[model samples]
Target: MTTEPTAADAVGPEQEAVETALVETVVASFDHCPDPRLKEIMVSLTRHLHAFIRNVRLTEQEWAAGIDFLTEAGHITDDVRQEFILLSDTLGASMQTVNVNNVAYADATEATVFGPFFVEDSPRVELGGDVSFGAPGEPCWVEGQVTDTAGKPLAGARIEVWEADEDGLYDVQRDAGRRAARGHLFSDENGEYRFWGLTPTPYPIPDDGPVGKMLAAVGRSPLRTSHLHFMVSHPGARTLVTHIFPEGDPIMWKDSVFGVKESLIKRFEHQPAGTPTPDGRQLKTAWRRVRFDIVLAPAGA
Candidate 1:
């Protein structure tokens, strides 16, 4: 004799039909999208998003709260701030994208988030010149070279660098007409590049808005470890955006946005007081020195 059907096997056809129709309806709406890639993305997004909502058994109140949270994040964003990026970052979505895009390349400096503070049209500085603009922090000597995957120097490569001041504030975060802690320069004939910058210090990830509240609610802090940001580019090379964290930072392994990578950490050496500087800046105090070498992949790579 056959056993009676159990409750687990009692799924109704209507239930399955409703769930499948929900996804198919959303996906079909994107069928007329002009761009094939966009259509494909929308279809996948619709399916995954529906699946997520169903799997979590999301309530109407919870969905409304999520929308409100995102709306607040958008309202707080401005020219010098990016709350949406912070949301993506804290969720590990930024790092996930980086991992997918940055395939392993031997000896090449690893990439990190291009944090919200980068400003376009940064003042150009010559090699060995100071970009600090008298910003208050321990002076730092940053030197590096840009090379190809094969270890060949790429002279004249543009190198853009920026960092937060000792107080963890960027130029834009301060008063107007300030361009400190950020500059752009080019590699020399031997692929060498150098500039005077401030030693990076640990800073918070703009925790005065919605993103901060989200982090707090989830028991996560908004502090990022001390680090310097760099963008290197050459005519035939892929533009590289990354950061170098100073070794021994208290939060080095606990960056709020998950931007740190083991290969990107560098030991910053402290020079003795009154040591002669390379660029002849006439500083009368001790300073920090960081050496970073970059390798760029071919544009098509």
Candidate 2:
């Protein structure tokens, strides 16, 4: 016993009713939002999202499974790790989006995924100090410089480095003897920096999570090539988080993250020994030499 103007109702009431009900529901459900920007974002998101559903005829099964996967992802995360990042990595979304946005193809240092092992607040160590925790492996010296796109020396640039030991395991993964195979160093006035650490060996990501489950389902290995992770930053320059693989490593070109750029592959030259370091510290034995050159974008670029 609803009465409506015939002509007006034909073009308006039903259609208006449906849209009003949907948009109102969205606003009411998301009333917890505090920021105006977030409100706008949710509004537009719901509108376009509904349009997508109408266009795609999506299935409920797919949506339910997605929610289930994400729920399990949350269950896997802990204080020392993030399973969501691993999911992003396995789906190629992490590498596709983060590693591409600040890419440097022309004389600039290429970027890559900063994996889950990166911990903050690494100790500051002297140039060429051995980062090896008590275990002995190959003796190696890693030297590098941080510069800008124009090749100008960058002073006071902070280059933070961490890598797996020769056994392809990080300090956090092993026993008490595994304390500090990672540290941060600042480039001197001449833009030069160097450190003594075991050359990193290729290793695989954790194989106990859903990402690992999915990879196993697809017949893929989680192996990343032997490389060292560098997170370099300076005032006014775009921070660069990346890695360099040994050029001759068999898996260098097949890194699971697909982060390798040809220009970033370094070569390790085995040398007997060189002159005593300026600090006059002598190695217990002969060591290998690995050279790396890092290029950073201008600050605030």
Candidate 3:
């Protein structure tokens, strides 16, 4: 004869107890954290993370693989390369962060991903000077102005610019001592600025790493559309991080990084050889030109 089950045995605690223990234990770990913000973030993250694990019934093998992938991404990151940022960009997390930080203003320049390529202290170029630094590409003239939301010029505002060469590589990807096709300049008294740069071209994000393999596994391409990156800032205004895409770039609408904004797309006009530049420098070959005026919102808005 067998004994009948008791109420405690019939109402098993395995499933519910385990999940409650996991979430409570993790959340409690942050209760003594000195920083209130950190403590709150930790508790919320723990809750969501535990919920996600329970929802997916995540297997140990899958968890191990994810850990390995993130480890590999960290292993490949270095001074000039940032695999983590690449991962964030391809996953749309970076864009989401940008959206949160950049609230809309009255016709202010839209913000986009601040990718992994920016180099501080880039060469300072004079107005109308060439930033191509001998990188191979068709000559292009970039003219723009920095203005407030009210359309008043912001003279002396800094305009930082960088872009990949025609060969789809940045200076940081090349020789250590060589800097090319990236620079910063101050606006003129009238808030006007101009510089010569290489025509933008589509390029693949560093795809020899884990993030690239993950993208490939998901049938995603790593190509970013042809565009020029700009960071415009004035003392009391919100700095704008944005890009201007060449109008006809095939991948603009489907940028792998989800960085394209309709307002940021500008038509690049092709000028045949023998055309004169804005500063009266005559071109030797066919070139392209695009004008992009920036409107900055008040800082801390």
Q: For each candidate, C-alpha RMSD in Å?
A: 4.2, 8.4, 6.3
Worst 10 residues of 1 by lDDT: 3-12
Lowest lDDT 10-residue stretch of candidate 3: 4-13
Candidate 3: list runs displaced more than 4 Å: 1-14
lDDT of 3 by residue, 168-256 (tens): 99999997567898999999999999999989999999999999999899999999999899999899999999999999799987898
- Per-residue lDDT over 1-301 for candidate 1, one digit per residue giving the tens place of the 0 to 100 score: 9987654245478886888887898888997899999888889988988877776677899999999999999999987788998899888899889878877776667788887888887899999888888888999999988999899999999999998899999999896467988899999999999989989999998999999998899999899999999999999988889999999999987899899999899989999888888766677788989899999988766
Distance (Å) between predicted and true CA of 43, model 3? 1.7
Return the top candidate by TM-score: 3
**Candidate numbers sorted by lDDT from highest down:** 3, 1, 2
TM-score, cand. 1 vs. native: 0.93
Across 1-301, the per-residue lDDT of candidate 2 in tens digits comes to 9775543334367865775688679767777888989888888888777666544545699779768878888998886658888777767777888665785545778788888887786778877676665544676688888888888888888888888877777777675234667888889887888888776678888778777877888898888888888899988788888888876888876777777878788887765665454346675666667788888876545
Q: Give candidate 3's TM-score.
A: 0.93
Worst 10 residues of 2 by lDDT: 3-12
TM-score of each candidate?
0.93, 0.77, 0.93
Clashes found in each candidate (C-alpha, N, C closer than 3 A): 0, 4, 0
List residue ranges in candidate 2 displaced over 4 A: 1-62, 103-106, 175-178, 272-286
